[model samples]
Target: MPTREDPLVSFKFGLEIEGKLTGFFTQVSGIGSESEVIQHKVVNSETGETIMQQIPGRLTWTPVTLKRGVTSSMDIWEWRQQVVEGKIGEARTNCSIVAYAQDNTEIARWNFENAWPSKVVGPEMDAGSTNYMIEDVTIVHEGVERVS
Candidate 1:
């Protein structure tokens, strides 16, 4: 049987960027009070392209809706690599876990600059659910990256 003590699902993802680190963003969504999904996307400003994006994977552990005031530490690391189309690539490593409050009424927002391969711990929410396919997501870069 499953218990509340266990998170409903847990998994790690990676994002590949091209060029120097420009900025990154995270949007965490919860089911009720436990952390459900910790999603993030990063952008490279120098070349105006997304350095990294989430690569979907399987969720093994039980999923928990994130709660407010709970802080999960994420160990973020980045590395530069090469890809197709002659585009510079960046690899992002996501580690650790954190929780953000969903009861906050303040405007949700976060900003980063020249911070590549960095881990961000904060509270940000929009909309989320676990019953069905929750589209809760965080878009870091709206641009595109092409490497040869």
Candidate 2:
């Protein structure tokens, strides 16, 4: 049994698109967000001293990218097509990235709200090299939270 203090392995993570495991992804990245900092200058009335202060402005969420071995499924591509056709709002869906323990027990999960595919990259072809055909999709989301 793994304790809470134990660090979860990165390779044991799972991805769920709209609450369903569509397929196994080889890589998942960009689970982060940042806020724009605004600097404010304050002047003292009595001493006439000026100081700069930093304040939080707008919050921006980084697009999450997922890479998986190419399969016969056209689900990811279909989602991207919707975006290209100006159906972005209707294409928005929730997604989850989950990390599991060695025993396959769910440990931690990050849920993303109103996510849609912003970009999709197909596998590069090479005649001399052998590699798994990988397809990647970048998902832009409005908000993300650690649900478990």
Candidate 3:
């Protein structure tokens, strides 16, 4: 019999860029993939009725977005600048997001390949209001998989 384990908390996770621990993020989303549905119509042999069948087409990966408090590091911005400057080929790199258990033991790791920042947004400014300066960067990748 297999022993049950509590679900790992996502709050304590880290993002690694090019195999190095980058920084802490408040939120990370868009970790998914979808297939394009292809429809085809066929005729029933006996009833001669038209029937539609759904077929899975090309697979598309969702862009992963990372959000965090703005810090002194300009790495994320520099990475995005590569895309903006038409140097995307140089921007592509393998990255990983690691989830940890309560005691900070590594629980799960999501590895992505050929990832490049597609979008990066800086925090909005308001003089009278006080809020943590946040920034978000969305990365598009060829594929992602969870390995251990």
TM-score of candidate 1 to 2 decimals = 0.15
The digit string of per-residue lDDT tens for model 3 on 1-148 reads: 9999986676566789889988878788888799999999999999999999999999999999888999999999988899999998899999998877667788889999999999999999889878999899998999999898
The lDDT of model 2 is 0.88
lDDT of 1 by residue, 54-94 (tens): 55454332221222232232222112221122333333222
Per-residue lDDT of 37 in model 3 = 100
Of the pair 1 and 2, which is ahead by lDDT? 2
**Top lDDT: which candidate number?**
3
Error of 1 at 115 (Å): 16
Report the lDDT tens digits of candidate 2 across residue range 1-148: 8757866675566778878876667788999999999999999899999989899999999998989889998988988999999998878999888877778788889999999999999999888878988899998999999988
- Give stretches of model 3 more than 4 Å off: 1-5
Instruction: List the global CA lDDT of all models.
Output: 0.28, 0.88, 0.89
Model 2 spans > 4 angstroms off? 1-4
Count residue pairs with overlapping backbones in model 3: 0
Give lDDT: candidate 3, residue 95.
95
Q: What's the distance in Å from true for residue 69, model 2?
A: 1.1
